[model samples]
Target chain A: MLDSEVPQEGNSTLAGHKKAVYARGGDGKMHLVQSAGWEVEEIVTRQAVDDLLRMTEDARRRVEAGQTSALEYHMHRVRMDIPLLAQASGIWQWRIRRHFRPAVFARLSPRLLGRYAEAMGLTVDQLQKTE
Target chain B: MMAFQHSQASHCESGVMASMLRHHGLPLSEPMTFGLASALSFAYLPIVKINGLPLVGYRMPPKFIIKGLQKPLGLKMRFETFRQPAAGVARLNELLDAGQVVGLQTSVFWLPYLPADLRFHFNAHNVLAFGRDRASGDYLLSDPVAETPVSCAPADLQRARFAKGVLAPKGLLYYPVGKPQTPDWQKVLPAAIKKTTRIMLDAPLPIIGVRGIRRLAKAIERLDAKNDAARTKLFIGQVVRMQEEIGTGGGGFRFIYASFLQEAAELLARPALNELAEQLIDIGDEWREFALLTARQIRDRDPLAPAALADKLRLIAEREHGFFHALRRAA
Candidate 1:
């Protein structure tokens, strides 16, 4: 891409930061241009962030209705899912999913709760209850 | 102690490797390293899901570049990882004390210096640890994506290096084990160019290379969003995110590859490759256009937008198919 053609439209997703891109200069050689941001980039990034928010909201509703445990709500609230929480905590996915049942989660041992809390960077108290 | 010079580049892994190599007296441009590794390609693996979204990558998997450059360039270097965090940290400090800039694989999420919005659970992000600040005990790092070098606390660096997840680093540390040798550009460039085209054009599965782009287009068109609006948006978002985000440098690495092509042409004294580089630039522009269209569609929420998005991808697939075929011959 030509240096002049590079987009410099700033966006919020980049948090007022710029990144390097290789663009053609007047000398017909490649040079690094600090691009403010691109709207397309912002759109996709916001979509990801917003999708997280959507999941969090849905989890909140499910927890409120008692269809699932606080585990579901707090998981997305901390920006994690079954795979991430499992990986970070070294817990099995099926066990994590099993805990989604309110009864099973309520009866969970303190040891497992400690593991989840550590993985999510939350306290054991915070793990048991939703904010 | 030798000073480690820091330079910004379009991508992280290759940039980190380039800086580390340059510090070791093997001054290589980021594009040169990336091209020599033949790291560029397209893959859409529906089977591999992240956050419930399918995987879409514009390049080969992580570690491909730093490792891929080995055989072709005769870059004999030490690549080691520690099972224990203490051992890894100790070795890193030892290397830094010896004036070695060490390349590290760390999770982007734990790096506090990055803007919070850009921090995610990506575990394969690369950075260079040049030294440690005596006063603060923070590791001085050169994150190529950032405009300037930054510092990270020892604890935070450990946390990032040991972040447990998919593609966990396991404290990966690598540096040049032997002095680098200059490659014969005439022979190496042609081979690299041929390998890249083969990667783009040859894949057993439809979900790889040019075929992968076509599969992605078909998936977009097949998305049934009548009642699942949010999920539909997520799918589209996932597709665009892979190309735009994750430090692709622009047009999902097309621009970077084009730059490499331009350099390769001059290196190999192949004037025809210069024209091919321009051709690739045009193709990269189309990719940008595709991103623009997809983003606008997400905002507009038109019922028929998926078809439009798919049509754009189809065009990109055709263009890439033609470009790779021509590039193979031109190089």
Candidate 2:
């Protein structure tokens, strides 16, 4: 149940407005309800997103420093772990692990690269780039 | 394309279903659609991990709402999935050209219009595509989670539809093949309520329903005993995500279920149903409180301890167990 009074304006990451939620009304009917923004829930959601973004950033830094391949970085950016990435690309886990190395990833064929790219929802060129 | 009204809903799948039904001349509220589908449930599968965290689902798996509605209402539905992106887009455009509003299962992370913080790899987000803007080549999207209809570039929409991961959308598209006749509430409402109640109270597996809640509480206690702060935080955070973020209507779908009960009470002219609705609302408040406390613990950087948190969860489980038990008998 939501607060009986209309919620006051508060900061939100949503599209610059409050969203309606259904709540139990006095008449025992469900009514369109509003909130002052779920600040606590928003904070938790942002923290999770920040944790993900940090991982992607770390991956990007590694790729830029030539410590890892762009495929590895893009995998983090798309929020897929190694095993999950392996499954999605339909490549064996050991083979996918090997591709994380810059030299190994660079020597991969275009057809193989295309599979990785398609799995990541990117083009072969985009997959190769650090961004 | 047909002119379809876009209304905001607390959850995506139900909202999309409601909007799609309304477009086909069968108007249904989000809660009503959700309730009729008997979509509510609880599961805590430690073995099923998403992003390396255990899965905690407050409802049945994806497409259950659509499938659930199909059987009871006798709706003829056409479901399509594509192996190629181009074919999927072509098929979607064909449906739009025929003025049919289509329901799409898409990855939330791939939809660029959503706030970045809210974007995750949840692949079962539902939206309706009614038309396309010829000038800009954008698809008119009625994303139920959003406040208003938005347009998505064709490329972005394609990525969302074809995103690969667990529960991949695979460009799944569905539409009702014909108009749905209004259902007989007298016959359907009680049965739907009873079925949902039975599942919640009587599911045999310990990993699901009331037993599942107890199982989660025990797991939380075990996690606390391990004293791994980071792991505990991650586990609790996933629970919050499943409860609040993943279209559970702010309290693990408890409020939505209550809303359904209220509506059912009116339609069936049963005061007892109304009383049950109130009880469900109270249970929903308890769930909300638990979420808030857990959030506070995380935000305040308090050390993870099983005693306090587990106690809270146990109370919730106990209350829900009793409530659902009574609800099952009453229904």
Candidate 3:
């Protein structure tokens, strides 16, 4: 990686930000060069992010279609799965899976809802109702 | 808090480790810290899933450098993880107030100061939380991957420190405690080089070292056989994201290791090390080429492009195998 070869293609994964990268300078030493971004990096980042967004959108549709509950949508929206949500909230995976059912989720106590909300970095109200 | 310099680095854990050690009066470059820790390696783990995608890491898992340096450098450090979040926060503040710079393992997603595009659920991101901002009273962080030192609100910092999942940080904070005993450079450098060669070439696991790259290459070809364009695209995207998107200093830390080798070449006056460094830079370029080809394959939707991509990786793997073998002999 030469300093001259530092990718400044401007379509980096970091959006507009630049970060330190080591590149060979004219002095034949490694210099900390800030990069504008790379197209290859941008595409991969967008792919991963878009996949998550797609999952969230798919969850939204499933919830609307009554195939799953709002809990499923919110979980994907917050970038978590069953095991992650369980670990974060200290709820069992089985119990969380059970709560994915609309009827069980509807009857949840406020305290339990608060735990899920806190684990996902959402307010309890936000957890209950989706926009 | 103000005692340490905030320097941006291509990678986080090694960068933060270097910063902390430098603040403690040990002068080590980020690349040097990384190489000494033997932190560079490739692992394509299918069993560990992130959002239904296999875990593809450019280097070893996080905190390897921070923990790896302790024994080799004769450094004594205090590491603490709290079951309670408040205790964790309190301990961090106490360390800061004691005029110590602390290294933290945090989740990238909860750190609000980062650009929205860079935030994800990946835990084990490392940063140095030095002290508080004068005006805003936020936790002043020297995030190695960020160009400038940034400030995080207390709430955000707390959330980040304790963010939960696989590799959940659990409010882990660490800092140097006692003065370090320096080791003999002649012995340490060569030993580090040998350890790296062994890891890259001798690790017995099928999913590690040179074998790991080959495993991933074969998996990519197998994935292409499914002829599911979306699935293949996502899997390849995961590889690119791990290699290029994550702060790998380009080519998944290959360039960084090259820099380290270059420095080692000069420090030890080992011309063979210099030769190896050049060889590595070429491999790093090959890795960049791999990324470029994969991107084009995604765009063209050419069915066989992925197998071609896999072929590129296998070539790189064989080159690496040879490189490490030569390195072992050089040491």
Model 2 TM-score, 2 decimals? 0.93
**Residue A71 error, candidate 2, Å:** 2.7
Model 3 spans > 4 angstroms off: B224-226, B301-304
- Those runs of model 2 whose alpha carbons end farther than 4 Å from true positions after fitting are A5-17, A61-66, A123-126, A129-131, B224-227
List the candidate numbers ranked by lDDT, top first: 3, 1, 2
What DockQ, on C-alphas, does every prediction get? 0.70, 0.55, 0.71
C-alpha DockQ for predicted model 2: 0.55
Point out the worst 10-residue segment of candidate 2 chain B by lDDT: B299-308
Alpha carbon lDDT of each predicted model: 0.86, 0.82, 0.86
Q: What is the lDDT of residue A120 in candidate 1?
A: 75
Error of 3 at B142 (Å): 0.5
Per-prediction TM-score to the true structure, in the order listed: 0.94, 0.93, 0.96
lDDT of 1 by residue, B42-79 (tens): 99999888888898999999999998888777887677
Ranking by DockQ: 3, 1, 2
- Give per-candidate clash totals: 1, 0, 0
- Model 3 TM: 0.96
Q: Per-residue lDDT tens digits of candidate 1, residues A19-128?
A: 89878888877667888888888888888887778888998899889889988888898678888888888899999999999999999999999999888767899888
**Model 1 pairs in collision:** B77-B177
